[model samples]
Target: MDVSDILAAQAEKHKAIAVEKEIPLDVDAGFLAVTDPNPIEKESYDENVEEYLQSTARDGVQVLLSALFSLPTTSSPDGPLAQLPPPTTTLPRAKPLPKPKPPTKWEKFARAKGIQKTRKDKKEWDEEKQEWVNRWGWKGKNKEEETQWLSEVPANADVDYDPTKKARDERKARVAKNERQHLQNLARAQASGAERKQRKADIDRTLATTRVSTASMGKYDKKLDGEKKLREVKRKFEPTEVSADVEKKNNLALLAKIGNVPAKRSKHEGNDAAINVRKAVRFASKGEGGVALARRAEGKAARGKAGRRK
Candidate 1:
């Protein structure tokens, strides 16, 4: 039976059982068919689809025209709607606002004193003291304490360098280098415009790469990323086909095709097969160039041997 007929039969069966049991439905879900009191009028019918498409096309065209017409003209510098400025009046360009300086204690005091600009710190020769005096920072405890701090240690004295002195110095140098690098990285991150984006991308690429281990430099770890995988030592397959097996006159041509050629120096030197291979070479001058020349020489040598034997 068709799906609708089957569904109707099932519904009738369910209705008959319900009536026999005198079953009363509790909710709308119990009913097979749902009734819509007032559904939204959707333009989904076959007859309305064409009209909907035409209406949409008209709306899209209007929107496109409105967008095109809304664009600002090159001739006008005014705000939206391309309004002109007052006649003969110059419009002053708005300058960029300067970054506000941080409020330091000295700067705050100077500002309180109504000073617009502060003098830069500089060393000057003091005429009264007959020495150069610093214009900024503490001079320290009356020069003698400073002299003691700056003085070199007496070599012959009981004082000696600590065991950790060298290590401390190295660590300090490393920290300084790291701090400078950190500053450079911070500058790149804080920078404005396209260069910052490129710098960030480069940083991300570096970070995405596998971290190399300090131990063995990945020499021991076979499974490490970016490390070369282990491969089995391959067997050497040479052209070892016998000349008698092929119809071709040239053994070298057979060797080229089959790739079964044997090495000249083999462990089985005293074997009968090796002896036969050596004997075969005397007649192998079958086809071209170097092989033909060598074969011709061998043939001549063999004929000479035959004449000597007689």
Candidate 2:
């Protein structure tokens, strides 16, 4: 048997790998995804649903695989690796974009004046030290005036005036002023938008509560002519229009729970004697009560002796 015919048939079978349709399949090799936009063939789909679906799916996969193989590959230890380009498809964000932070007073002023922001270098060249030193950190160039041995004193300087102390104080004042401005900016940011409204509402509620918390509960207090009456919140309860059977079942369940609870014991129930010890004590003491029985017993002998002598 000649195998040339079998080889030719196999080549013909593999020749038509390219799928054709009115709308081309969208293939993203980077994302390894294929989208088929062609309308389904009604006759083929109606004749055999599973076969038609499988052929459609196979065509899409064939196209995707062909695209993948066309990409340039690099040699690797395991095999040749194809480097995928950036994905063309854009995906939606998982979460909403964050709100912009409120700007500070300085930022607003700078924007209004059309001033561009410029970053300062962290390190500056020191001519005396012949090296680059930090601008504002430990042993930085900014502290040179305070750390220097000699300083220029003003003509009106006081007797106790020290140049080093003055320079240090000025530096500290600048740091304090920067910190204060930072705090002010933070306060301004927090006091903006919905948060500010919430804070104001809380304050109003607190004030209303305080107004009613007085000697007479604000009942006898003088009220303004245009003042609105405060409406107290009412308690919520289950509706009376519920099904009778459901209500009956609920009532029975409640009764069952109440029945399961143990009853409260009497004060003398703790005593386990055959007779009622508390009642006997009360009778023996002539209704002076069980607690006073000991005191009565202590005075009984003295009373008996006094009666006999009489």
Candidate 3:
């Protein structure tokens, strides 16, 4: 082989080797390849980048940087800046409140004048109606107009007042008084009823006692009269046609039955002796020859007695 053929052939072999290795031979192409691979190279390059950032911050150099070098670059007309948007600001709005209603005419009058209109004492003026009125007098109302009719007389008129209302009140008071009196009367009647009941009870008790006493006294008197009658009957009648011995025995039994002698025994004996003498005189009179026959009998009796003595 000649020297030219050997050099050309060696150059062609080197070209083929570059093509097989996929390595560009152009300087600009190589620069692009190096720059393009920088992001892959920077996968562990944060340590060095942090040191560089700290140095740049100390030197007061503002710079724009991205973690991925392949990312698109940002433009700044002012200077190198941090990769961030500006802060948003907003102002607060104020809300309005509702207003209160105005005061009424009457309320305003009350507040300003310090006086209130009343039914008993009317006010001098009506602000809404705009009219004058009596301060302390009656004011009639027009029913059709629905407004007060002022008096023709002066503001203060003294009308003749009727005390009939006062009289009516007095009448009511009297009625109440009468009611009170009626209640009192009822109370007294109740008390009187109780008293009457008590009196009736007392009368019944007295009548019961009187009846018992009268009955007892009447029984005692009747018993005494019966005893007197039995004694009189025994004295007035005696057994007739009895012998002297039997009579004497009967008299002794009657005396024993009569119990004790009387306190005036002498007077009783005297009357008994007198009654016997009277009975003997009546027997002599009843005999045939009155007093003469009695004398002859006495003479004969004397002679017989003399002969017996001799």
Candidates' TM-scores?
A: 0.16, 0.54, 0.13
- Cα lDDT of model 2 by residue, 3-95, tens digit: 999999898888768687789899998899999989889999999999999999998899999999999999999999999978888999999
Q: Write the per-residue lDDT of candidate 3 for residues 1-310, one digit (tens) a residue.
A: 4699889999997764332213322212211211111122244345587765454343222111222233344768985433433323333557666554345444567879987665554456656558876543265221212232432344554585334444446656867987887676666555656678898889876754554476564345434332322211245555577689988897899998885467588564556443566456557756543576578789999999999999
* Alpha carbon lDDT of each predicted model: 0.53, 0.88, 0.51
Candidate 1 residue spans exceeding 4 A from truth: 1-119, 124-129, 133-158, 161-186, 189-195, 198-310
Of the two candidates 1 and 2, the one with more favorable TM-score, higher being better, is 2
TM-score of 2: 0.54
lDDT of 2 at 261: 38
Tens digit per residue, CA lDDT, model 1, 38-89:
3323755355977765644444444434434555546545644543323333
Question: In model 2, what are the clashing residue pairs, if there are any?
Answer: none
Q: What 10-residue stretch in candidate 1 is worst by lDDT?
A: 25-34
Locate the minimum summed-lDDT window of 10 residues in model 2.
259-268
**Weakest lDDT window of 10 consecutive positions for candidate 3:** 29-38
Clashing pairs in 3: none
